[model samples]
Target chain A: MKVRQVSIFLENRSGRLAGVLSEVAKAGVNIRALSLADTSDFGILRLIVDNVDAGVKALKDSGHTVSLTEVLAVEISDRPGGLAETLEALSAADLNVEYMYAFVCRVTEKAVVVFRFEDVDAALAALKAADISVLPANTVYAI
Target chain B: MFNPQAEAMPREELRKLQGERLRSLVARAYERVAFYRAKMDAQGVRPEDIRGIEDIVKLPFTEKSEFRDQYPFGMFAVPMSEIVRIHASSGTTGKPTVVGYTRADIDNWAECAARSLGCGGATAEDTVQVAYGYGLFTGGLGMHYGAEKLGAAALPMSAGNTEKQVMLMKDFGVTVLCCTPSYALQIAEVAEQMGEDVRSFPLKAGFFGAEPWTQGMREHIEERLPLKALDIYGLSEVAGPGVANECLEQDGLHVFEDHFYPEIIDPETGASLPDGEKGELVFTCLTKEGVPLIRYRTRDITLLMNSGPCACGRTSRKMARLMGRTDDMLIIRGINVFPSQVENVLVRIEGVHPQYLIIVDRKGNLDTIEIQVEVTEDLFSDEVKKLEALRDKIHYQIKAMLNVSAKITLVEPKTIERGLGKAKRVLDRRQRI
Candidate 1:
């Protein structure tokens, strides 16, 4: 299963991140989980939003650099060894994760982790064989 | 003084000598150099018309682009058999401006340099280090031969290798340091880093040139190195680094009117400006044999001082330190960089927009350049590594073209401001210092 994620390029200037957030809010898009990866000159704002298409459109219309990335949303137990077990399974199958971020779903008491993998197909097959539940695109959007 | 007779010649005698040299130089150029002949013919003037320095206004002015038009050796007045040396300007994009020097021309250059060193109070017992780049660039060899001509031990340090530069400066007990003003400051910084006191060295004076530096920078270098910081001005097209130099008076650089005649003209109208009025500095080679130029327009902006006797006993006219350039050319660490050159490199690369901005700054004691290029839609990848690769590609291309390192930044499309009129391409924050 694949999840749609929205990513926007942000220059390392004052109030740029807030400007992107205000644009997303004006479009009535709710961001569920987010992560900011930064360097000295610029940063990338990655968001797992409820409305991916609307968020991307709003950011682009605001003259922001935006892109859509297909990632995996895996549901894991909300326990101490949850991430460790899932990573062990991917390592056993020789799959690599480029980057990953996590958020807890309070109602279900489960951790929802967003992962970007180099070999998505192989990673999906490995998770499927390892019996870890991969959330569907619609399920990730609803969460 | 190196040549007291020429340096301190009376105003009437100096003017008489300049007038005679100007007449002979104009006639030689009109007869041998086709470019000068065509320019003079188009201006409805003849060699006979320029009878003296007072009639120099009738001669046509030469622009830097004329050198590019002539390419490698098209402008040389003498044949290859008589040419002894050649130096070129670091042209970033197209063909470089080439200059040729005959044996006697080189000797005259050395003489000018010797006089320049003498202005800094250097003597035959002094150890001089020439830190300008040697090959192709006129800075290094120009100072090297000048030091030797002055009977001083010339150390051809030739720019870069900061560690070695500092070590030799201390070990050799260098008395005269000839380099770009910025590099002189860099050397002081490196010496400090090595836990060595620059003041403890035998450095008595320095001849700084090949770039426009401010009085504040002069104060910084002098204080740090604890030596007299003298300003020397020259360009490769006009006999290189010995055209003018600051005598110990440190007021303005004294132009060597005996060899290279100086003039100031309005940049826009090309009309001659009065003395003490700021305008573009133009030079006419009075005695160069290989490639004598007639009224060459040096785009550098400065004013002429009154022709009078100086406390240093020199009666030659002086030119104030350069204020600014009339063109968009940027001199980063003694190397010429134009915005169009960077655009040339960007347009040739795939998935890069022509729109760009050049940001030049002085970090610590060195100059740095950062170029921001807009990324096209096709090139903007979600992965940061891909964008970094694109930046690296642009960086390598620029380095290969300009022979200087730059930090290339990939910005989003439409992020760099666009102007309705002439685009603002350069953000130079270094000039403030």
Candidate 2:
């Protein structure tokens, strides 16, 4: 599936976030999923927008520093055993999860998981080899 | 603003004045300067044949390269003992172009410079702090003599030592700051970090030049220092810093037509361009006796507009702000690129530091372009992959923007060499055939 994500470095200043968001919105990039990782001096704002290219362009044209990364979307269970099974499968595949976050699923009673891995294609192949549900970009966007 | 002499003299009267001076200067050059005499004689021309200003165009134009070819003191009209001051260019190769000035030349230079600086509304009561580099660079000495001639309290602060500059600016009540535009921003940044109140400082105006700057940067510097930013334009061989300056109205710079004659010529064709048409700027020193240059091509791309009375009521030709130089354009794989374009790209990228360089080299039979960009310390990461990816994305964006392939290399902040006087931003390695 599609896993294009935009990672932007933004100065910790007033109106900076609004400036980036306004440009992206003007470029018609629908907000898919978003999170901000903060550091002492600045913050790294990541986004999964409907148009990854447009979002990257918007952030760039508006003068915010941006980088693109491919992330894997893994379908995990909403219940306690779901995420544990997924992690165990990844660990068995010799894959390392750099960071991950929870996302809502389109299907009822299920959870969607997004993870940044050391090797994106390898991680996806590992999960698929184990019969773990690896969601596509369309499915993740819908979720 | 228009020059009062050129605008008000009426075309015929201006012609007569220029003719009279042209004949006198030509006759003097023929008699006193052996080089000019030889060149004119080789063409079978006499100074008497150049009777008027129209005849000036007929005479061969002297170039800066000719001075370099002849080396030190070959073009001086007067004897060696009469030359009171000697100035030189800082070029590394060949003999540096040397300029010699007589006591009278220095006086005229100071007067023209003072008149130009006077356009800024600086008075004798004002303390003028010279922030440009001193010694060999004519920018510092040229402005210094001008402010002194104006009877302004001159502080030879010279360059750098930010703390001392700010200290003198505060203690001496400096009213006018003189330096390159880039240095002005650097000083402002230092002042801001030190919690100095720039507005409270006595600086009412800044005479900034020796570098090309954009209108946005001009506004930024004006806002930072809370003073009127004035652009001063000139070169070391022609007469640095005081050749042209913007008036209070700030429409354009008024070339010192009384002392220096300006003509816009097509850089490629060498044909004279009409006023309001952008072209290369060329100047001839009519009054300068020390190292007088005739039709020295400055290669700076700008337009000359003679229409409309300026906010200031002078009659000189107003030169539009320089766009960029034709000579400074970088050729990449048969494509011409200007650093200004790269600057436009970098400045638009948030957190990309202003310190950047364009490296052009010959890779195989083709050319290669690498943009060395500085990463702000705040954005520095420990991970190489993350940084490498960022560099690749920048490379792609610049390639898209300029329509040329480029490599982006990020250097640690403050690693790029800082300039002492004129900043060197472009490094071209292709051997000229």
Candidate 3:
């Protein structure tokens, strides 16, 4: 299962992240999980929002460089080594995780982890074979 | 001294020589060049009208655009047979401002350059490495022949190849360095990176020109390389890189008044200003044969010092170090840049808005320019690689047009500020105290 993640290129100027967040807020989109990759000159703001289409549209209208990325979301037990176990499974299957971020759902005991993998299909198959629950796009959006 | 008698001649005697040369130059230009003849005729000024240097103000000023309108060789006084070499400055469009030199003109160029090197304390026993670019540009060959004319060992190691330049400097004992000041700093950087102490090398002095440098840069170069850094001034239109040079006194550059007569003029009105007043520096090529220029507006902003003998024992007048330009032309790492040139490149590329900002600054004694341009909504894609490719495309086009590298930052549309009147296109932060 693939979840759509929104990534926006932000110049490394002050208040850029806040500006993007305000735009998403105005669009009535709730960000589920967010991560930032930054260099000296620029940064990439990635977010998994409840309303992807509306968030992307709002950001694009605000003159931001936005992109859509397909990522995988997996559910794991909220234990000491929840992320470590899922990562071990992917590593054993030779699936490279480009990046990952996580958040816990309030209604559920399981922690939801988002991952960008080199091969989404292969990673999904490996997680399925390993008996690790891979969340669907709808479940990720609902969270 | 390259020409001891002329270099040390009395002020009145030098002025008399300049008067004779000016009269001869005006007569020759009036007879040979139709452009000069037409300009003089329109002004109702005859060749005989210019009897001395005082009458020089009556001559019409020669603009750089006249060189472009003439194109390849329309300004040459001599025929193609008498021409010995040609050099050109990069033009805004495709056509460059070409300058030709006769055999005697070449000799004069070499002599001037030799005198310039001598001003930097270079002698016959020294080995000078000419690192300025060769071919079509006057820097390389001008310095090369000048070093040879001074009876010094000339290392014709043109521009680039930093490692090799350092190696030759060490192995051959390069006592004199001839190149842009930025490249001198670059050589020092490479030498340090290679675990070689720049101070241990035989670089006793450096003749840095083709670019505007600050006292801070001079201090940095001198401290890093532990050598005397001097500024040399020239242009391709005015007989290359030896029209003037700073002597050992580290004062203003002494103009080779016997050949090239210097004048300060109000850039707005084209009226000659007296010495010691800051104005546009203009030159009249008094001894040139191929292309004898009259009141050629250099666009360089500087002032002429009082004419007298200096402590260095030179009688020629000196020009203060260049402050800036009368126009918007930016000299980045010795290459001339105009805002319109960048605009020209942006206009040709699709999806790029013509509105742009050029930011020029000095980083590590070298000039760096960053051009921020706005792209259309369709061009602002979600793909990072695609956006990077578009940025690279603009970068490559600008590099091809300007012959200088610049960082291209593709911003969102309307990010660059717009003004109601003339849009502020350039922000030069260099030379700011």
Candidate 4:
């Protein structure tokens, strides 16, 4: 129903994002999925890591500002109109998706899209009512 | 209450006394200091030309660079034998501005500092904690002597050692806290971290000076520590921390006009501006014998509050809190910008901390300013659009207020350097022509 996403603030300078990723890598934490939201001056690198505590500690030890966000990861069909169908259900429920990113699963014909909604619990209940498959925290980390 | 007679003197009588002091100061400067004599001769204005305080404009304005060029003891009116004490303030460039004090000068400074403390409601029963750094800097000793002269218990605690400072405040029952406003904030933070309620302490008033602080910061300190935060203004070149201070009314700082004559002048043309007009501040040491400066340009930007006498019954004129310094003003795209204006906008906005850094640079044909704002945990959002919206809001407000387009950069919390003495606000990287 919810996944813990690690968000690191990266200044728009060369090697800043690389430095952040390397900090987590030095702690032997595996990154499952990641998305970068950027502007001309700065960027926010959001990641779904296998070991949340280890990754956070590594980043913190390296003096990087890291934030933990609870986002919903839902499984949709890989075919076209899959996202549009899920979005239509969400629109019917009036759940607002603040921002979202996705990653494909090689094991199944489904794709996991991470969504940051205004209300996590409300979004979770809406997806459940719409019969959408919501991936659990453990499943997202393992995938 | 030390020296009530002088503090509350009638305006006309004060003016008369100021005129007499100015005449003596000019005569002494002309006879003793070669610098003053040469400057006066070049302007064709003799010592007799300045018969009253009204004729102060006849005196040549002394720039800060002149003090540095004179160096060690060239500006001293008295010989080294009569100079009992020496203090120097660091200049922006070159040699530090050195000042000497005779025994009378020290006593006068102490009297002024005592009067300043009295403005904040200090008395013989109060214990003052001087947390401003001691030695070389004038803040610590300046306030310490004032506390002593006021018949209050003086605590020379100098700066740093936060936990101990709080403990001493609790144990020794310090009634008055003296330090920069930022340092007071740091003390409050340390007290809270130690699980000690500073408001429960017996602090009645605080004298915060040496740097310009906003009204918001004053409220923050007062709310946290339960003390009347008063602004104390001074410069080592004239006399340290006791030059002027805000009385209990908290309207404006009452300048000790008899000791230091205050005047406002247009920084551009060096023409005298009337009271209540915003301009550069120039000070003339009226009775300073050791180092008598005649019409020394301070370069601080402020307006003289022309309102009637304060409610506290002091007839002395009050000066508005400093807006900014002339040197601190940055010209970007043919517009003058002050860091205080940027700070004014930042404090009014929600989710934005007052701590920020302004970086100015030249990009080819135009000047560029980049404002780096710290993103607090409460302001941080997972959505990129929300963060960008925050940046845009800051950009729009700055553009609307300052009329200068700025690049707003959101950085992580605590990334900008914070100086305990005076927080560094501006960084100019432009190539000097």
Candidate topping TM-score: 1
Write model 1 residue lDDT over B102-137, tens digit each, in one string: 999999999999999999899899999999999999
Quantify all predictions' global Cα lDDT against the true fold: 0.89, 0.75, 0.88, 0.88
TM-score of predicted chain B, candidate 2: 0.75
Cα TM-score per model: 0.92, 0.58, 0.83, 0.62
lDDT of each residue in B180-275, candidate 2, tens digit only: 776777778777778899778878989988766657667878888977999888887788778888888888998877677888888887888889
Interface RMSD of each: 1.7, 7.0, 3.4, 1.7
After superposing candidate 3 on the true structure, give the runs of residues whose Cα lies further than 4 Å from its correct spot: A1-9, A12-14, A29-143, B92-94
Pairs of residues clashing in candidate 3: none
Isolated chain A TM-score, each model = 0.96, 0.90, 0.95, 0.98
Comparison by DockQ, 2 against 3, better one: 3
Candidate 4 lDDT over A18-46, as tens digits, reads 89989998999999999999888788999
Native contacts recovered, in order, as a fraction for each?
A: 0.20, 0.00, 0.17, 0.37
TM-score between predicted and true chain B, model 1: 0.98
Q: Is candidate 1 or candidate 2 better by TM-score?
A: 1
Q: In model 1, which regions exceed 4 Å deviation?
A: A74-96, A105-111, A117-134, B374-379, B409-420, B431-433
What's the TM-score of chain B for every model shown? 0.98, 0.75, 0.97, 0.78
Residue B325 displacement in candidate 2 (angstroms): 2.0
| DockQ, computed on Cα atoms, for candidate 1 | 0.37
Separate DockQ for every predicted complex: 0.37, 0.04, 0.18, 0.29
Q: What is the DockQ of candidate 2?
A: 0.04
Worst 10 residues of 2 chain B by lDDT: B1-10
